[model samples]
Target chain A: MSTLNLTAKAREAATSGDYSELISLVPYAKMIGIECIKLGDELVFRLPAQDGNIGNPTLPAIHGGVIAGFMEHAAQLHLIAAMGGQHLPKIIDFSIDYLRAGLYRDTYAQCQVWRQGRRVANVAINAWQTGQAEPIATARAHFKVD
Target chain B: MSETTIRPRAERFLSVLKHCQNLGMTVEQADSQGLILRLPYSDSIVGDPETGVVHGGAITSLMDTTCGISTVCVLPEFEICPTLDLRIDYMHPAAPGKAIYGFAECYRVTPNVIFTRGVAYQDDRDNPIAHVVGTFMRMGKVTQSEALTKAVNEGRA
Candidate 1:
């Protein structure tokens, strides 16, 4: 992809559903320590707790920005994997609703591609900390997949 | 608010956010218009290696932080406000090696919610890299930490 220069290894990982190499390709993803695991055909994104990700030390809550960032990347990576490594999508816009304060703990996210057309793709992302039923944040992102 | 009061308050307020410090953001200006915060370019935040463009997530972080804190400028007193929701549009990738600035203004402050809108620009305010509109829930007055209170008093002195 012109947007992201994916190496052979990265491409292979993309097809094999091994996202470690793909995650490392983006510096910010690595900086935030994002990890992915494939559960049956679904991918679940994980963000391990780190001190740098905290927003309010008083509540010890995860920064709302960090939660947004993590959700956005998860959606991007999920889109990449879903498209079979065809191309890297550029985010056009994102709308996120913070359901609850993201606590300072390991967080998880799952993305679902609502629709994909020739030029664009829409993704819905949900992030949770303690349980899947209680999402900390939910977001919809539009990406330019051209 | 006067620059003298807004400056330290902004600095103090930002200092409490650990992620803001991690991103290397600083309060550039705070006035009636709103809060202008800067996010410096860094390799650690780069999204595309080939182009060296900082990640959209970093820009999102800057805008979220900017909009969240902008409520202080409109409110009668400082209150703990949490982001209820945010919408961001990335116009384009920011130019590498240049800092990005977020200017956010709380346009409306209701009894329970505050609305804010802003843009992330580089050198020219007209050409923004991104635009954002966000809402936050007022959580009542903030319970200042002992250290923060002490720091504010010392800063004032």
Candidate 2:
């Protein structure tokens, strides 16, 4: 398939909210069990509680790295979804702050594109397990999007 | 303090962490210098199938785990330290089919927090795939989970 045709199809998949097709392109996201769902006009990503994703079995907390990875991927996917798959994002840098322990539960994340120029895009992501007001983690990522 | 003593403890620590186990991480070295961890390349970790490159998140996980554990080298006793904040810069994508190594050192340890800096590289430490600086909050000494402890004991037996 031509690269153009492939991107067109990916754009279609994203625009129509065929999240599985979009997610299948990245294997790590699938391996870690990330899913995307649309509520109203916003997209929300979820990481369901899994034994293999735990870090401290004592508190039964989700791994900090897992939380970071999830937020980062969520931001990337959101960027793709937002741009209608016109551009692929390569992460330049990412900074994340952990506000609270991510307990072992279904985690949800939402991303907003803070700014997007021609070559770079900045995204802010927030992840929460129980309540959105009390976020477990918040992150900012810069992606080179051409 | 001693490699012989800390090696087994580190190995046992890695085995119980489900995420570390899932990523197939192994301790290459653990001593006063810091911690060096190996993340074996696998299909499950491939981020871009087109280029056969590993995901950035996998690198983040490896560095995070390495930095978090580096606290053990500085502290007198085991404590439950959680990541406070972390910043990672992706210099480049790791080569496909090559295992990535993460080396982290606890540079500063305050009463309330531990500071760390690390690099993820393949083959050459001079050329890093990514670099990370992180801070972790120092919680009190670990309290073993009964269920996890039982599982570990049963597996050993």
Clashes (backbone N, CA, C under 3 Å), per candidate, total 0, 0
The residue-level lDDT of candidate 1 at A112 comes to: 98
Q: Provide fnat values for all models in the order shown.
A: 0.83, 0.77
- Tell me how each candidate scores on DockQ against the true complex: 0.65, 0.62
Candidate 1's residue-wise lDDT over B32-142, tens digit each? 679999999999999888788999889999999999878768765556788999999988889999999999999988899999999999988888999999999987655
- Whole-model Cα lDDT per candidate? 0.87, 0.86
Q: What's the TM-score of candidate 2 when only chain A is evaluated?
A: 0.93
Residues B1-157 of candidate 2: C-alpha lDDT, one tens digit per residue: 6655555555666777889999999999998888899999999988776677898888989999999888777877566677899999999889999999999999988999999999999989889999999999987644544554444334441
- The local lDDT score (0 to 100) that residue A139 gets in candidate 2 is 97
Write candidate 2's Cα lDDT for A24-73 as tens digits: 76789888889999988889999999888898777789988999999999
TM-scores of chain A across candidates = 0.94, 0.93
So what's the TM-score on candidate 2?
0.92
Stretches of candidate 1 above 4 Å error?
A: A1-4, A7-10, B1-3, B142-157
